[model samples]
Target: MIIGSSERVPLEKCPALVLNADFRPLSYYPLSLWCWQDAVKSVFLERVSIVSNYKRKIRSPSFEMSLPSVIALKNFIKPTEHPSFTRFNVFLRDKFTCQYCGDKKDLTF
Candidate 1:
């Protein structure tokens, strides 16, 4: 379990969902998630604004607050209008299946 926090949740138990300035997910196919450390750092750096938070809290001699569950970038980043051809892109386009075998299980590569 992690320390110096109000909640004793394991570090891996919570990850903040990251979003673009428009409030849409940064990446839909894989879903953008940032670890707690990065989330907190982004908050402190003012690179991102917290949209939502978990009940869990972290504390320091100087400050104490809940961990962000969702965050959005302060500046907008445009997504590409077209996706490049790659194996991962192909899988996302194909819904992660082996087209020839019709196998959708664990097509991770």
Candidate 2:
């Protein structure tokens, strides 16, 4: 009994990437892609707006770097492989207790 307008649609309120019909990356916008806009194959929030386009500068928290704020990116170039056994493994093999003092042996030991 109720009809909703395009503005009332919840899907239209989110920000997403717009891909071309051939499955290529295109421009980004705040509004969600509608069926009338184009054939949206996928939507992702990979890019972060750290600074404005203008000359105005920005600063990150003092805990880390200023320009690159150590933010996580959406896409990873390659999957990370797990590391093999190392000297740390020998320490861990000892149940974190020093073989000599029985004290909790960390990397400092």
Candidate 3:
């Protein structure tokens, strides 16, 4: 399906923070997220409930709705004992600080 163009949203701001049915983030390590398109799709599908909204609204000829800032699933999902390994996860699990010097900026793998 066609996604956004430059004329639409500024890509960076359109991401929604995805939460589990319990209302906590789906994944704390990665700061669970979904793009605007996916968030909107889930809303229409009744798979998620909007917990918060951004001021911006997207409009088409037939409808309009504010972009979701936060969303939670309708069904609870059990979290795994071991979260998947990923760059963001690693950073998050480590608390985003350099272990050696305690610097909180410019971290990298």
Which runs of model 2 end up more than 4 angstroms from their true locations? 1-66, 77-82, 93-95, 99-109
Ranking by TM-score: 1, 3, 2
For each candidate in turn, give its C-alpha RMSD to the true structure in angstroms. Answer: 4.4, 17.8, 6.2
Of the candidates numbered 2 and 3, which has the greater lDDT value?
Answer: 3
Candidate 1 per-residue lDDT over residues 18-107, each given as its tens digit: 999999998887799999999999999999999888878878999998888889999999998988788999988888889989999868
Give me the runs in candidate 1 sitting further than 4 Å from their true place. Answer: 1-6, 101-108
The candidate that wins on lDDT is 1
Q: How does residue 19 of candidate 1 score in lDDT?
A: 98
TM-score of each: 0.81, 0.24, 0.70
| Model 1, backbone clash pairs (residues 3+ apart or across chains), number | 0
Candidate 3 — which residues are off by over 4 angstroms? 1-12, 84-108
TM-score of predicted structure 2: 0.24
Task: Return whichever of 1 and 2 wins on TM-score.
Answer: 1
Q: Number of the top candidate by TM-score?
A: 1
- What lDDT score goes with residue 27 in model 3? 70
